[model samples]
Target chain A: MSDSKAIFLKDAAVNAADGDQRAFIRKALGGYYVNRDLQKARYRDWERARDAASLAKWSAVNDLAAVLEQFVANFERNGGVVHWARDAAEARDIILKIAADNQAKAIVKSKCMTSEEIHLNDALEKAGYGVVESDLGEFIQQLRGEAPYHFVFPCMHVKREAISELFTKHLGTAPTDSPEELTMIARRHLRQLYVDADIGITGANFLVAETGQISITENEGNARLTAALPRIHVALSGIEKVVRHLDDLSVLLPMLATAGAGQPMTCYNTLYSGPRKEGECDGPEQFHLVLLDNSRTRLLADPEQRDALHCIRCGACLNVCPIFKNIGGLAYGTTYQGPIGSVITPHLRGLKQWNHLSGASSLCGACTDACPVRIDLHHHLLHNRRNAAKEAPTLFDRVFHHGFNFVIKRPWLFAAGGRIFRATLPLLQKLPLPYMGAWMKTRDLPEAPARSFRDQWKNPDA
Target chain B: MPDARSDIFARIREALKVKAPRPHLKGEPVAGKTSAAAKPWLPDGGESAEASLAILAEQLAKLKAMLIRVPDHASAAKAVAELAAAKNWKKVAYHGHPLLRPVAAALPCEAWEADASFEKQRLEGCDAGLTTCESIVAQLGAILVSSASSGGRALSILPHAHVVVAEAAQVVPDLGSALALAKARHGDQMPSMLSFITGPSRTGDIERILVLGAHGPKELYLVLVG
Candidate 1:
């Protein structure tokens, strides 16, 4: 087994038994499920809306090169600078160079998972920049010196008492159990940093081709201030974020809200065309958009699973995945978690090392049903498993299959083995037998089937 | 390194050769095959203006946003004065706009205009921010505010409470129309920033529990005048 897969098994076992962690995930997601259904009903037709949303992303992703080229031209025309990074290292260097050129002292950021994917915070902090996460969950996670527990709800696993303790240790604020009060503590703290920071970094939810604007959707308004207060604004986005037109957002944004968060609309969905234009009141003076490919083109190369790139990062799949609900996000150990992550991690990382993620599923279609853009998630996992076996089947896999084939080819040997297995079935079931024991813990070896298929065929109605 | 721009494009070009089709549109891998819906996929505000207004009010109520309607601009100003007196606002921040200047003037407290350029600290210190919006959406009770129209981005977002003053004519039925309106208003000179604000700043981040005013205004009031 791969190193990542081993870590995943160990973590999954521990987390699945963590009563406190399980309760937090269940309670939080219970609310999300209720709200999502209620808000979904607000749509004229939810399934039809899903199809429309899917096509909107499909059109952009299928015609990716054209739409991206158009977007780049229009964005540059809008007086914003565009930087293309081939991989994570290049993306990190590009952002560092931008900061150095701007002579930035401090940086504030809204929640951008792409940044996390490239480890931008670590890169920037190593280069002697004080980077602060402005999104409340991200802020808490940052203060705790941890990765986001969940991508969207960054610190979902943390209790309020723990959060209060974290704040007291870090920010030196009075301890409070109130979620609202804890939010105010961060708000009060980040306000000054926003004013002082020379650079603000953010993530783009959708990059509109026609208008050349990046739309950022968030429930809190931190993204607004992060983009507004800083003199230099830098946004990092994956190349797959492009949508065909401004009107596409009109369809995509509502579904993202309802499916992801169960809201009529998130509190803020802002479009940024450029730096503060001439004759504008206040905004960043220089706008830089870094478009990172970072092996996404590799995923794009696989036509069978190409629509996985259509993910809006609304995280609806993560919310509904039974595996995610049980094992939690940390165990996945990828930048993205849940079904979407499992389907694409092999493509984004590598097939051999990450293929175990595909096996982690129960072939449940909850994620496919929950996806706003209708990426065939479960089928993609199956494809990953097949491709992995074809590409590099382990020696154990080969030997086991060979042994089974050798026995099955000889009818007498197979019959003898079956007779022995049936006779010892009760003992085998009772004994704790390593791998077989684990398997049989949740399953039963069906009552020895009374007689074998050959015996049943020989007798008329045995 | 290796001309990232052209290289990335080359990879994309090569990748796009083998087209992937949506399940329903399998023959030739149709680009932009938008499914024609029998009814509008999103909630709609009927054909009439009154219908739009009624839906907008109901949506706003659900969002916990206060919507104030007035017969005229003078009543709008009076409403602001009364709200300030009731809330006991110490200082208010606003930008120079014909629609909202009077409302700011009636604040009966230190009113600061964040004009073309202003200090961030001054805006941050204000109790409430009053600004003009480009358009309001009735479908989701979303207010579309642009940097050019709303005295820049900070005025609508920086303060404790954001009270937007809009005319009834500015109300649109849906988000798509709101974007169309922006396109008509700005053409190529689009505002550096355009934000669709649904409710006050909020987060369900902490334990996935709802909490308002995470990093922006806690209270949001929309004052509409006819």
Candidate 2:
């Protein structure tokens, strides 16, 4: 096993058994379930809505090259600069150069998982530039010196007392256990950052091809502030974020909110066509869009799993996934953590090392049911398993299959083996079988039948 | 050296040679056979204007945004003044529009109009922001605020509370109509910033508990005038 796989195994074992943490997550998501059902009831036909949402995104992914070129042309015409980064290193370098060119003194950012995926903050910090997370959840995680516990609800697992303590220690605020009070503390603290920050960084939820716009969905409005105040605005996003048309948001925005957080719409779903127009009141003077591929095209190369690009990042699949609920988000040990993550991580990173994720699913298909864009998440897990085995079949794999094939090919040999098993079942149960200790630890051998099924079928009267 | 853009596009083109199967929606048309105008499956917005307004009120109430209706522009101003006095707003920021200018002038508290580009620090000091919206969607209680209509981006978001002044004629049935309105008005010159304000800014980030204000507008009100 790879080092990441080992750490993942160890963490999954520990976190799954953390009953208290599991209960907390379950109770927290209970409200989400109720709210989602309530909002979903408002839909004329929720399943049909999913069909449309899926088709809208598929329209973009199906003709990606042409649509991307069109988006770039329109975005440039709207007075925004576009930079294409083939990988993470190039992306970071491009951003750093932009910050240097602008002589940026202060930088504030909203919640962007793409940035987290590329480890952008560490790159910026190592280069001696200060960056602050303006989103309330991101701000808390930043002060705690941790990655997000969950992407959408970044610090969901944290208790109130710990947050109060964190606030007291970091912001020098009075201790308070009230969630609203803790929120206000972060709000009051970050208010100044938005005003004073010289440059702002954000992530695009969707990039519109026909309109050349980027839509950002947020509940807290930090993204709006990030785009509004700074003289220079830089956005980092995955290449798969582009969708075909502006009207597609009409179907997508409501579904994203109802599925993501159980609301009609998030408080802010803003679209930016470009930097501040010549006669507009106030916005960033310069807008720079950095498009990062970073091995996404690898996943795209396999046509069977290309629909994985249809993911809107709603994080719904994570909510319903049994493994995610038990082991929690951090145990996945990937930037994305859940069924969707399990399906695509191998492709994004590498099948050999990350294939362990594929093995962890229960294959209940709850994720497929919950997915807004209909990615076929559970089957992709099976695909990864097949692909991984094809790539590197181990000694054990060869022996098990070869042995089974040899016995099954000969009916007489199979029947003899079965008769021997029936005769020695009791003795076999008592044996401390080599290579089967872990499998037998909590399970018992089944009772063997008196006659083979073939013999019974041949002598029906007897 | 080939550009990263070309290289990425090249790979995508190669991958598209094999097509994936269409979604398994029973009775759904095959790929490339679906209608050009995709129908939304959202909540029903009533056919008539009055019925739409009723739906808007119900939706807004559920979303925690208060919608105040008045007979005319003068009554709208009176409502704003009353709200200012009731809430004891220290100062407010507003856009410079005919519909809102009189209301801004009549505010019980000091009002600053951001008609042109302005400083961020001053707007940040205000207790509330009042702006005119492009349209309001009745299907979902969404306010479409563009930079052209809403006094840029900062006015709506920077303050502690946001109050939007809109005419009843601006009310539309659904989200699609709102998008069509923007496209019809702007054409290729899309506004740099166009946002759909759903309710007061909120977050359920802390232990999944709802908090009214996380970064912007703890309170949101819509003063709808006929």
Candidate 3:
């Protein structure tokens, strides 16, 4: 991607001091509002336990870190193994070792962003294990052999006809766009894998340190079956996923519902702590939890950015983010793409590598407002820019910040500098403007009129 | 399990330097402080058991899942057989519920109880899989599945087609009510496999196109036996 396109948000921000951000916010707000109303009504029944249960759930979050460690100990004592990996490489090794030791031939996976972070599928597939993504969106992406576009809705970018064509090519059937036909096609195909698979892998939406149970929520029964049918089940989650108690599930579930899909709760909320007890007919015989730090610990250490840990991976921030809507997920150039991605990616991958993501947002506070846990996302993005500046400031950026600091400090030079730039715009336009002018490619730039906006405001009718 | 769960949580809290992250807990009211009227999980107001069933049926119907109203157990069994033949489902797997006996006997296709044989038969080719729901919740239109005796866990899940028979009396208002009923009925002896299915197996994974039965039963038939 062109640097301007790659850092599209940075380009957009240079010219977005006006009402441009507001227009983007208006569009995204429409989408969020429509989805929110639909979800409330759709999962109205689950909402009955909304108030009491959800409150209980948040109490657990208040004591999350403690609860999570307890959950890890319990899992180990119960004969379930727990592995802590500080980064993706370590996480992938832990999983690969488990898969190899078990002599896994084929594996099934539930949606787990942690696994995505570690690139578990490629690692496993490279070792010659057939891996299938059980979640419908994941499955579609898996079939196309691609990565998830969004955290929850992986194939949210794929259209229906595209899916029909995907199925037709994969199954050698006539292309059809009806959801029922496509579902039947996938069902017929995936059922065989459920029984035949040797290992099941999933992501935990919440790890109840209380129950030693990894809570996975999904509408399709795949996660349940994925975890249940396989002989070995592996759960991957970030350290921030833990909560105090099962009672806390009530609070978290509703928040996830409202934030993820606007539902009160998903259809399936399956919790598996360890291996099934005696007399249990289904579920894995072996259970493993890989606690991945993957920059979470570093993020936790940074007092300014630690709140990023509070994210439940609900994707609420992305759904409500104005910049995310127009750019879609692919532009972020990481497993996670969106407002949360922009803030977290630089921290996880280094601000120097992804300084562009820091400046990608419209700085609209919609993401912060929409966060169920109320993460200050816009503030974090600004914080990311600061980190980038400190870690990898360009010569131009250094000069600019120094010049900016000087201008604001010295009113005379500041005024003169503004006048000079405004007057020299015509001359600069003729000289083929660089970085700042890239913004004009996708957007129109208004000419600087003879009268300044500040001057006009002072005169009222100037 | 309770003690173990609690102990684990306690220790983890200590290890992680778990402090009370929030200033004040935000959740259910302190009992009487909140109005009793604040029933978030309940319908508009409250729905009677029967009314909940009606609403559930309507919702299921809207999803294109077939809900057959049978007068008796015999008719319910016959209805299954009729559906099997009508849908051209040849290889069939039956959860050995007493309610399904007549249907299993009547169907011309090969029938195996939810067992290893059923699993083998399913692998070969099955047009539909038949089972009886252990319970149904009206509020969310969910059906609970237990794989203890009749239905094998695999039979309910690892099939392209699934048909479930539920007693109208078993339908409750919501998940909480459903859990309450399960707790009361089982009294600590939970079933081996209890699955609550709302709509047919569904996924909006692809561009938000809600695809039904992606990994589980693609088509779900609910026979609401009166």
Model 3 chain A lDDT-worst window of ten: A46-55
TM-score of 1: 0.96
- Show pairs that collide, candidate 2: none
Better by TM-score, candidate 3 or 1: 1
- Considering only chain A, what is the TM-score of each predicted structure? 0.95, 0.95, 0.86
Which should have the higher TM-score, number 2 or number 3? Answer: 2
RMSD of each: 2.4, 2.2, 6.0
Q: Report lDDT (CA) for all predictions.
A: 0.89, 0.89, 0.68
* Candidate 3 lDDT over residue span B27-115, tens digit each: 53552222222344433312786687677876567555778899888888788888887888877887766777677887867777655
Q: How far does residue A223 in candidate 2 sit from its true spot (Å)? A: 0.5
Docking class of 1: medium
The pairs that clash in candidate 1 are none
Estimate, for each residue in A166-252, the C-alpha lDDT of model 1 and write its tens digit.
999998999999998998898999999999999999999999998899999998899999999999999999999999878777778
Q: How do the residues A1-462 of candidate 2 rate in per-residue lDDT, one tens digit apiece?
A: 798899998898899879999999999999999999999999888888888889888888878888899899999999999999989999999999999998897899999999998899999999888999999888888999988877788888888999999999988999998999899889988999999998899999999888899999999999999999999999999989998777788888999998988898899999998999977889999999999998888888788999999999999999899999999888888888899889878887888889999988999999999998888999999999888878998776789878989999999899889989899998988888867844575688998888888989999777
Native contacts present in candidate 1, fraction: 0.78
Kindly report the interface RMSD of candidate 3, rounded to 1 decimal.
Answer: 6.0
**In model 3, how large is the Cα lDDT of residue A241?**
80
True interface contacts reproduced by each model, as a fraction?
0.78, 0.75, 0.31
